[model samples]
Target: MEVVRSKEFIADCSWGAKDLASMNGISTRLHWTKEPYKWHVNDGEEVFVVLDGKVEMFYRIGGAETSCILESGDIFYASVGTEHAAHPIGEARILVVEKEGSV
Candidate 1:
């Protein structure tokens, strides 16, 4: 068993993550970021949870771009083939769950 303090966790660099678990080909991770992530699509669905700070999440659907601001405790679900990226308002801590080895 292990205890992870998400708010207090820090990464070595922007968008760096700490692996928390992997089971049945799915992986859970805690990420720290101070910048925007590149736009990309995951091989499978993704669950993004904001644990601290704020984030501006951008995505494209049917080739139409959209975005939303997510604060702590907000959750974003990205279905498969969803093209998305995250721009943190500042230093932010996020919990992400997705397929193992997925970008």
Candidate 2:
């Protein structure tokens, strides 16, 4: 058993992550970042949860780009092949669940 104080978690490098769990090829991880991640499509679905601070999530639909700000406790779901990126408003902690080894 373990306890993680998500709000207190920060990484030494941007987008650094802590592996929380893995089950049947699905993984749950906690990530801390102050920089933006490059846009990419996941091979599988993704569940993104903002645990602390805020994030500006950018996504594309039909080659059109759009974005939304996600506050603490907000959740974003990305289906397979969904092109997206995450830009932290500042320092933020996020919990992400997705197929293992997905990008």
Candidate 3:
């Protein structure tokens, strides 16, 4: 038996349960989990699409909170200088996109 896994960022879900589709400047990540964590983006704009779960997309602005709920097919985007986070309420697969030069 043999098992192959991605050597990229931390993947909390099953390695074989998800497929990663990526190009030189863009990538799509898939996952299935009810667990949650905080994601940090150093700079640039980021977009997230919820594939199959309930999610709470939150952002912090000057000590206040702005948020939204994302279900299947729902998408959210965070522009530069906005600190945002997400929490999974159910199992899901998420897609994240970033501009080519926007690290």
Candidate 4:
């Protein structure tokens, strides 16, 4: 129900990097130097776009772990059923729209 501009959001660039639509069930996340960890989707899918730095996203497909490195301007996504995780290979800024009602 609002607009976010990355170049202006002073505290967290990830929160303001994109203009997000108010979804039926949705949320957003911004990770900085908080922690180096992996994550997985419990229910729905999420679409992400890297604003800065680099992130390595891994997912298990066909019993194989597939990896992809996302950099600035890179747009990537994972579905609800995908067994995936992500960690900052280096420093990274990303915007994610996570499906609401999901863990």
Q: Give the candidate number with the greatest lDDT.
A: 1
Error of 4 at 18 (Å): 12
Task: Rank the models by lDDT, top first.
Answer: 1, 2, 3, 4
Worst ten-residue run, lDDT, model 2?
6-15
| TM of each candidate vs. truth | 0.98, 0.98, 0.67, 0.69
Q: Is candidate 1 or candidate 2 better by lDDT?
A: 1
Per-candidate Cα lDDT values, in order, are: 0.97, 0.97, 0.65, 0.64
Off by over 4 Å in 1: none
Write one digit per residue (lDDT tens) for candidate 4, span 22-56: 45667675444323445565577778777767778
lDDT minimum window of 10 residues, candidate 4:
10-19
RMSD of each: 0.5, 0.5, 6.3, 4.1
Better of 1 and 4 by TM-score: 1
lDDT of 3 by residue, 17-74 (tens): 3445556766555555567656555367778787666788888878788888898899
Give lDDT for model 2.
0.97
